[model samples]
Target: MSRIMVIGSLNMDIVSRVENYPLPGETIKGIKTDVNPGGKGANQAVAIARAGGNVSMVGAIGTDVFGDQLLEALQQENIETNNIIRKEGTSGLAVITVDSKGSNSIILLEGANGLLSMDDLTDILPEAIKDPANIFLLQNEVPWETTKNIIESLSASNASIYLNPAPAQHIPTEIISKLTGIFLNEIEATIITGLSVIDQESASAAAEKLIAYGVTEVIITLGEKGSLYRDFREHVYFTPGRKVNAMDTTAAGDTFIGAYLASKQQGYSIEASLEYATAAAALTVSREGAQKSIPYQEEILQFLT
Candidate 1:
């Protein structure tokens, strides 16, 4: 099976459904509420496992009830959580407000996620990621410094590295250089490149900037407009998103990146993998919650056809 290692956040998500987003200082009525296991890392790990890849997670949760539930949920998805640590603080949480339009606004509290220290990472050692079978998946939810150290430790390994620079932050050019793959939205890409991405043209320009910075490949997600991808060979492709009524856009990009990695590890071609990834993301937006919305491989295959 395709083996994957993810270093990111694990969070408990509390969701509230409303008629529409409340105005500043204005209260609105909600239809329902629920709690779910989330965090971009956990979502991606579940996605990979559900898509038939072997996945492991290295992140921290708090020593709280929510953290306990998050771990249980991940175990149900068959993700390897042997390295997941529990800290003293509250687990990270995302307070999500979803409107009837399928749009969402989130308030993220980086709680125990901040406690994932270099020591915790060093404990996992080089073997976890040093082998050729490992593909490292990273995001910005946790401390980028710790991520930098991990990337540096694995720099000489034959394993591949995939980074999703979400909630984009200012990182060194060297980190960008180490990536085997990168997934970003137009806005995240713009944050890195300072490009005015009003459309595909600007998106291309932004991707070019990333390539110039040493990323081997780049994939820029453009919401409903679709996605743009470029490889080392200068071959560029655009995958148009399939339009459907969206229920909640939470975790859509995470699902896309996760499924894409899983498909690639399963030996699917670039085009086919993107198609599968797109379909997986499409299914996520049709539902609610983070991990709750990720589709199974069978569901994605059906959607593809």
Candidate 2:
């Protein structure tokens, strides 16, 4: 298995189920509430592990009870938590609202996630990136400076650097150039490229724009419409989404990214990797929660068959 390292945030998700989203200034009662382990980093780590990858995680959590539970959850998924730091105060959190349509809106509290510094990564990355087959996965949940530092340090390394720019932020072209692959949703693509990505054509255009900005490869995920891929070689294509009755779309994209990388590390071609990832993500949406929703490798393979 390919060695994977996820450097990002860990959060406790406070989820509320609702019939419909509340309008601005509107107050509505929630059908139910549940606290789940989440955060893009942890979610992806869990996805990678469940998809049969060797994965470790690097992030921070607080000394609070939620932090303990979140760490336990990652361990339960067979993710390595040795690199995870324990900080003072509260762990990160996400207030998520899911409607009957399985769509969701979220508000983030960075907390300890924001506290991750370049110093935190300095001692770990050199060792982590030593193996050429190792992959370093990152997200926008951590501080931009910390991410920048890691990328800069690894620019000359052989390890693959994959970035999922969720909750899109302004990233420097220099840092973008260092990435081996980038995964982003339509909205995130739009934010990064200043182009509308409502359909395949536009998504392709947006992906090309990102490639022009120096990223070696780019993938724009379009929810139920599937995803678009573009490489520095000018190879561009779209993979149609697998049709499924989505119950909760949470962690669907994370599952796709993790499974795709895992497949690639296992030597599958890009097309095959995308197919496997699509099947995995489709299964994820048919379930609920974040880590709870990610399908195992066997489940994904059976679904694909």
Model number with the top lDDT: 2
C-alpha TM-score for every candidate: 0.93, 0.93
In the range 1-305, model 2's lDDT, one tens digit per residue, is 55899999999999999999989999999999999999999999998888888899999999999999999999998899999999999999999888887678889999899999988877898888767888899999989888888888887884689899887877777888889989999888888888888999999998888898888999889999999999999988789999999887889999999999888878889999899999999999999778889999999999988
Query: Can you give the lDDT of residue 54 in candidate 2?
Result: 87
Residue 233 in model 2: lDDT: 98
**What lDDT does candidate 2 reach at residue 56?**
96
lDDT of 2 at 115: 98
Error of 1 at 126 (Å): 1.1
The sequence of per-residue lDDT tens digits that candidate 1 reaches over residues 197-257 is 7578898888888898888899999887888899888989889998878876778999999
